[model samples]
Target: MYLLKRRVLQFFTMILLGMLLLVLLYSIDGLIPFLIVIAIAAPLIVGWQILFDQVQPQAKLAWLLAVLFIPFLGALAWVMFGRTPRRHRRVKRTSSEIRMFRQAIEMERIETANAVSDRFPLTRTLQKLGATGADGHTSTKLLVNGEAKFEAVLRDIEQATHHIHVQYYLFRTDDISSKIRDALIKKSNENVTVRFLYDGLGSQEIGEDFIEPLRESRVHVEAFDPVVHPLLVFNANFRNHQKLIVIDGKIAYTGGLNVGDEYLGKEEKLGFWRDTHLRVEGPLVRELQRLFIENWLYAGIEDDKETWDLFANEEHLPEYFIDEPKDSNGATQLLVTSPGKDVTIRDGLMQLMMEAKESIWITTPYLIPPPELLALLEVAGKSGIDVRIVVPGKGDEWFSFHATEYYFEQLLKRNVRIYKYNRHFIHAKTVLIDGKIALVGTANLDFRSMYLNHEMTIAQFETSSVQELHDAFLKDFDESILIDWSILRKKTNGKRFVEAFCHIFSPLL
Candidate 1:
C-alpha cells in the first residue's frame, strides 16, 4: 500500500510538471518572435556557462560548437540530458534505513599498502590522487575468460556461509545467468543472507517473473536506481556499471564480465568474448563489499525511512567496519569513481601517465576519449613512452566507433601506436604502466565511464599480478592489426563527415 501510494504520488507529480511546461508553452503561443529569441539567447547563455565552467578548453570548445550548431538539442535539452547527468540520483537517496546502515558500517577509506613494498617517492603522486596505495601481501588472481571466472564465482557463492553481496551492471536472464540465479536461490534457501543488487537500466530485460523466484526463496533482490516513471528516465547515462561479488566479507570477484551467455562466448553474433576478471582474497574484499553496501543502500530507497530511522534504529554493522588494517595476504587498492564525487578516475589515470617512465599499454572496447585524456596520451607518446592502445576491430556501437576514429589521426601523429583486435571483441578495461602498476576493473576510458557512471578500478602493485596482465596484453598484441596513419587519414568525404558528426556528440555519450 505504501509503495503504491508513493509511486502514484510520483506519477502525478511528473504529470503536474509536464502540464506546467505545456501550459507555459501554451501561454507563449502568441509570442513566436520572443520564443525564437529565447531559442537563440538561451543556447548562447548556456554555452557561455559551459565555456567558463571548470571543463577543459578543448571540451568546452567542442560543446560550445555543438550547442551553436545542433538545432534541436538547444540549451534546454543540453542541460537536462547532455551534461554528466544522473537519473538514479533520486532513488539512491530515499532509502534512509540503508543510509543509516551505511553510516553504521562506514570506515575511513585508508591506504592499506605497505611502505616497505610500495615505496614512498614512487607512489607519492598516486597518494595525492587519493589512491589507497599498494599492499604486497593481498593475493590476487587473473581470470582470463568468462567461463573460468563464473565457474570460480559460482563455487564461491555455493561455499558462502554467512552472507553474500552480489552486484552487477548487466544481469541477464540467460543460461549462465540462470545458473548464477539458481545458485543464489539455493543459498537463500539455506538461510544464508543473499543480497542481489542490479542496475535498473542494464537489467531492464529481466521482469518480475524472472526475479520472483529469488524473492520467494527469501533472497533480498533489489534494483539499483530503477526508473520510477518513464518520463523521469531522460538519460540512462548514470548506470551502475561496477561488477562486484563479495561472499562472507572475505572474498570478492570483479571485472568486465557480466552475467550473460554472450559473455561466455555462446552468442555467435559477438563471437569469442575476450575479457578479464579478478579473484580477490585477503582484506581487499572489505573495500569491494563497501562498494556493494553503499549501492545496496541506494537500491533500497524508501520515502518514509527518514522519519522511521530516528526511532527504529537497529544497526547490523559488520565487524570489519571498526577493525584496523594490518598486513594482509597481498597488497591491492581500489580507484572508485562515481557520480557527484570530488575524486575521479580521470585524475588518477592522468597522474599515472605523467609518472610513467617506460610504457603504457591500454585495452578498451570503446575509444571515445575526453580531450584531456587524448592530449595526455599524445604527450605520453611524444615523451618516448611506448604508449600502445588496443580497441575492437568491429564496433558494437556505430557512432561510438566513428567518434573513436576521429581522435586516431592526432594520436598517430604523436607516434602512439593503436591496434584493432581482429579476432574477437576485447572487453578488458586494463592499463599496464611501466611494468610496475596494473589497473583492472570495469571503468572504461570513455566519457560515460570516466565521468557519468559508477565505476570501480582496482590497482595492483604486486609483481605477479602486474606480470600476468603484461603477458596477457602481449598475447592480445599478437592477434591485433596495427593502424596505418597514411591509409586512415585519407578517408572519403562522406565518411569523414560522419566521423566528425559523431565526434560532436561524443562528449555527451
Candidate 2:
C-alpha cells in the first residue's frame, strides 16, 4: 500500500537525518560540549519518561527505550513522543478546581434530589448521572445551527443585567463576532461586567488589534493557553475547545457553535455550516457560571462579591450533582477527564461504547478514533447491536477527513453503518446509547480531542433528552449518505493509500 510505503520512507528519512546530524556534530571537534549536552538531555528525558510511565506506560516504554539507546536521537524522539508539561500543568489546575467545585455543590444536589425524587422518581441512570433531583425553574432549548444559536446569543447579551461571561474555541473578528463584540462593549459601558475568553490557537487568524476596541471599552478579554511565549508554543497542541456563555448566572449557552465566519456559513469556501447548541436556563446555569469562573481565575481574573452574588440563588432552587471520584450513580456519571487527570473523558467514552447493549448513535465532525475504540465498535457491531456513526462528508481539515476514511473499510466489514452528512459539515459532537443516555459537548471522537485537548461534555440521563438526541440522530440519518463497503473497496489504490498514511499519524494528529 502507498501509505505503508510512505511510513517506511518516512522512517528511513528520519534515520538518515538523525545519522547525518550526529555525524556532523561528531566532526565538530568539540566532543566535550556535545557529550555535555547529551549528559544534560539524557536525564531530563529519563525523568520525563519515569513520570509518564505512571500514567501512560506505552508512551513511557517507547520514550525510555529511545532515550536509553541513542541519547541524542532519543532526546529528539522524546520531545516528539513525550507528554507536554505546559499542558499537563494547566490540566492539573483545571481538574483540581473542578473537583473542588463539584464537592462544594454535593450537599445542595442531595437536598434537591430528595425533594424531587417523589415527583419524578428519577431513573437509576439519571441518579447516576447526578440528575436525581430536578429544579422546576430551569429550562433548556436546543438550537439546531450556528445562525439560530448566535441569534439567541445576541438576544441574551442585549438583555444582560449584571455580567456576561463568554468563552469559545474560535472567536473571529468578522461581522458575526463583531456584532457580539459590540454588544459586550455596550454592556460594559452600561456598567455590566463583561468578560470574553477565546482559545489562543483557535483565534490565531484574528489579530489582537481586532479585539482592542473591546478592551478599550473596559471589557475583560483573555486568551486561554496563549502561545505567545517561545517555550509555550508547543502547548498550542492542547486547546480549550469548550464554547460556553453565562449571562448573569441565570442563563447559559453551550455546544458546537464557535464565533467564526465558517460557523455562520459566511465563508464562501464552506457554505452552510451545520451545528448544534443548547441554551440553558435555571439551576444548571450556576454550574456553567462556576465553570466560567474557574477559567476566569485561571486567566488571573479576580471574582468579586458582586460577581459571586450572581451565582447565589435566593428564589429558584437548584439541584446540583457532585462529580464523585468513583462512579457512584450507575445511571449517569459526570466524567471530566483531561491529560494527567485520573479519569479521562475519552476513557469514559470508551467505557460507554463497550457497555452498549441495544444501539449506539454518534455524531462528530472528525472520526479518528484510537485502535482500542475502533476495536470496541467492531466488537459491538459483531454482537448484533445497531451501531451507527454520522460524520462530515466535507470537512474544514482535509488531512483529518482522509484520515477518517481509513477506518471505513474495517468498520463496514463489521456492519457498522457510517453516514456522511450531505448537506453541510456536521460539527456536533454527541453520542446516544440505547435511547437512555447521551453525551453532548465540544469533545470530538478524534485523537487530538481524546489525548491532547481540554474538552467538556455533559452526560444527560433524562430520558426526554436522550429521546430528543435520538430523534435528532434519526433526522440526521435521513440527511446523510450511507457509506457502502463496496464503494470504499472501489476507491483507487492511491487514494486509499493516502488515507492510510494519514491514519498512521492519527495519534499525533
Candidate 3:
C-alpha cells in the first residue's frame, strides 16, 4: 500500500511538472530560441568542463556522448552529479581540521618509516595517496563472513567502555540490525558515547520507527548526504560506502558486511551470502579511529567541549593512539578514497598488481573494472602471473552483474582465469598477492567504488591474518567453477546483447 501511494504521488508529480512546462512554453515566445541557444552551448560547456577535470579518458568520452545525444538533461545531470562540487573539494582538501589530523599522525609515520620502507616499497606512494605508512605493532584477525563479523562486533560492543563509533553504507531494520541496535542502545544507557553514521541513499528505506528509538536512547545519529528530501534525491551519485566500527579506541572492524539480514543469508533471493571482514587491534585501530571521526565531522555533527575533548585534539588523544612500536608479526596500512579526494584505493591496487610476481587472486561481487586496472590485469595475466578472479554466480544487482559478464572475454583472452562461485553470492572484496599480502575492505572492483563512493581498505603485509585470508581464497577457488572458452560460447545471444548494453552504461553504474 505504501509503495502504491508512492507511485501514485510520483505520477501526479510528473503530470504537474509536465503541465507547468507546457504553460511556460506557451506563455514565452522567445523560449524556443533560448532553448536552442542552450542546446548548442550546453554541450560545448560540458565538453570543456569534462576535459578540464581529472576524468579518465573513457569516462570523458562517455560524458561527451551523453551530452551530445541528450543535451539538456545530460548537462543538468553533469552539473548535479557528474563532478564533485567546488565546495566539497575545498572542504576535503583544505580543511584545517584535516590538516591537524594529519599532523597528529606524523609521529607514527616517522617511527615506522625505516622498517616499513625496507619491507614494502609501495608504502611511500600509497602514503602520498592519503594513507598512513605500514605500522608494525598492529595485530589483525580475518573474519570470514557476516556471521563472524557480527559476532565479533556484538562482543566488542558489549565490552566497549569509552565510546562506540559505527558506520555503514546500509543499515536495514531486519533481525540482525535490531540485534545490533539493541546492543548499541544498551551501551548508550550505560553512559558510553555512541555515534552512528549511515548513508542516506543506501538506508533510505529505514523508517522513523527504527531511528526514533536510537535517538530516544541518546545514541547520536547522523545520515551522510541524506536523500530524504525530494530536491536531494538527485545527489545519489556519491555515497559513503565504508562499513566501519571503532570500539573504545582500541579495536576496529571493517570490510564488506553491512547491518542486514541478507548479509546473514536470511534473504531468499541472494542465498547464503559469502563475504570477508577484518578485526584490527594495536596501532592500526588509531588510524581507523581517525577515519571514523573525520567522516563523523563530514556528516555535519557538532561536538560539545567534553565530547570533542574525548575524541579529538592532540591533548586528549587516546592512549591507544600512540601505541609503542612492538616487534609484531606483520605491518598494516589503510587506503581511503572519497569522491573529490585522491583515488587512493585504485592507485594502490594497481601498484600492488604491478608488484605481484607470483600470483594475484581477487574476489569481489562486482567485476566492472576501470580501463587502467583492466589493462594492468591483462598485462599481468599475459606476463605469466597466476591471475585468478572469483565473482558471484548469482548477483543482487542487475546492470552491474551484466556489465561484469561483459568483461569475461577480454580477461580470458589475456590468460586471466575467471571463476564463478556457484555455492552462493560471493560479496567479498579481497585481493591476495604472492601469498604474502592481502587487501580487504569495502571497495569493489567497479567504477562506483573506485570513483564515486567513499571507500576504505586495509593492506596487510606478511601477517598471519593475510595467510588466513589466502587460505580462504583457496577454498573459495576450489568451490567455484572456472570460466573458459566453452563457458563463453554457451552464453545465449540474448544474454550477450544484455551484457553489451549494460557495459555501455558501466561508467554511470
Point to the candidate with the largest TM-score. 3
lDDT of 3 by residue, 1-509 (tens): 01223334543554565466566667888796775576679778887898887766667777778878866556665765577523342264336555666676555442355777688767776777667767878888899988899999999999988789999988999999999999999999999889999887777777789999999999988888776653335565677899999888778899989889999899998899999999988778878888887776666534323233345456667443646444467788999988865689998999889999999999999999999999999999999999999999998777778999899999999999999998879999999989898999999998878988889999988988998998999899898999999889999999999999889878766
Show pairs that collide, candidate 2. Answer: 125-331, 128-329, 128-332, 129-332
lDDT of 1: 0.74
Steric collisions counted per model: 9, 4, 0
Ranking by lDDT: 3, 1, 2
Q: Write the per-residue lDDT of candidate 2 for residues 1-509, one digit (tens) a residue.
A: 01233334444655786677667666866675876676677657566655645434444554565566766555654453345534434555555554665555555442344433454343333444433233434446667787888889999899988788999877878888888899899999999989888877677655768888888998888877665632224454456778899887667788778887778777775587878777766555655666676666465423323232233334322322222222222222233445444235676677667777899888988898866778889999888989999998787776788988888878888989999998868889889877876777788887667666667666655534566677788899999999996677689989988998777556555
* Model 1 misplaced stretches (Cα beyond 4 Å): 1-80, 84-124, 228-232, 303-330
Q: Which of 2 and 3 is ahead in lDDT? A: 3
lDDT per residue for candidate 1 within 278-383, as digits (tens), equals 9887656666766777677566645423232331235434432323344533347777887644345778888878888999999998888877888899999998
Distance from true location, Cα of 139 in model 3, Å: 1.1
Cα-based lDDT at residue 69, candidate 1 = 73
lDDT for position 82 in model 2: 49
Model number with the top lDDT: 3
